[model samples]
Target: MTLNSNFREAYRQAQSQDVIGPNVIPKALPFVGGGLILTALGVYGGLGVISNYPNAFMPSFWVALIAEIVLFFVARNVAEKGNNATATPILATYSLLSGYTLSAIILVALSTSGVGLPGIGIAAGGCGITFIAARQIGSNLSDRDGMALAQTVQLGLIALIVVLLGQLLFSLFGIYTPGWLEFAISGIGVVIFAGMAVVDFYIMPRSYKDEQYLSAALGMYLTYINLFIFILRLLIAINGGGRD
Candidate 1:
């Protein structure tokens, strides 16, 4: 997803910084947790509308998706200026809308046999596991190792985006991705974003000053959410396209 195009900006800024904000991750953790909670609430609300007011779901979903795109850029801009009071709410709202738009995928997971709540749980759990490992390894990286990993992740992201665009263009022409290709793409996405989880730790401290924790939070939130998304996609692909 282009949802994290903002991260490239963060990565660019990280290259120039010689100092790291050792406290930023600790400070940003609460907001990350809060944003995620809001996201869950939004998902709950979206599921209700989808279940009970099916006719409105698609229209409302497109609006929410567009709003999310707008809010993300606005929040990042404000956060970069250190306007925490303004940016915090915008990021929160963006998180909520993000979950709302994700309802369609979650609904598909819910419908697939042997891949309902368990699949969702597993995807979420996978992100939590990634965070634990990333925190340890990402924090202790030698300077050379850190730079090398960052370069690898950057190239991976660029290549992944190109493949994804190709997939989208083909779908628009009624040439949807075959099941095996879908599985392969989603699996690669899982690997790429898992690498990103590590990079966020190494990059955030270098990219942001103490005042810009919201930006860090936004980046961290994007990492895990995208991880969640790709994991869910992998699950759906593995289960044979959400239904028989």
Candidate 2:
């Protein structure tokens, strides 16, 4: 089916548009905030290790990266099964590991001439702004608008994943994306995740029932994290694309 038709079929029956889980968003918001804070702590710790014991940083980073990937699937599975007790620590660890891996980009941003702390702040502020706007827009969307927008962003996300995979493959061969392509990729990433920030507000209510708040929280956290990464990437691309 065409995207619009598919959305129409899927969401037409979900006519209420009211959030399925009234408590989900409220409960998830706190966890989301806590997760981000933990991520910041992880980044701080990672930065220290990288600066003082640079050799140790790479091995530790790889371990953390692998663990982070594993934890994501583990936590997601537990959360979806409504095992919040089991998922909570797993998700927290995932967030911290995520931040540790992210420190590499944070390091790049820090070293870039014009994309230092201020750029990080801007990227963060952008997410905050997007959240506020999306909450308003996505929460009130009619079934049609909400589903259409969600599907569009879903397509964008799939495309983004494929592109990122391609970039990773090239990197393995020591071929980094050029400055111009970096701008294109980063720009597209920023746009797609910004769109996802909106879609999350719409999808959560329909996708997760009231009891699945932990799963909902994980979804929101991923959206926020990806959005932050892309915005930071854009800043780095603009200021000093080839430097890193």
Q: Candidate 2, after superposition: displacement of residue 80 in Å? A: 1.1
lDDT of 2: 0.79
Per-model TM-score on C-alpha atoms: 0.96, 0.91
Candidate 1 weakest ten by summed lDDT: 1-10
In model 1, which runs have C-alpha deviations exceeding 4 angstroms?
Answer: 242-244
Q: Report the lDDT of model 1 for residue 40.
A: 91
Candidate 2 residue lDDT tens string, 1-244: 0011122222443445566766677778889999999999999999999999999999999899888877887887798778988999998998888889889999999898899999999999999999999889878888788877877876776687788889889989998888877888889987877777777777777766777787878877887888888888888888874534
Report lDDT (Cα) of residue 11, candidate 1.
76
lDDT of 1: 0.87
The lowest-lDDT stretch of 10 consecutive residues in candidate 2 is 1-10
**Clash tally, candidates in order:** 0, 0
Count of clashes in candidate 1: 0
The local lDDT score (0 to 100) that residue 163 gets in candidate 2 is 85
**Best candidate, lDDT:** 1
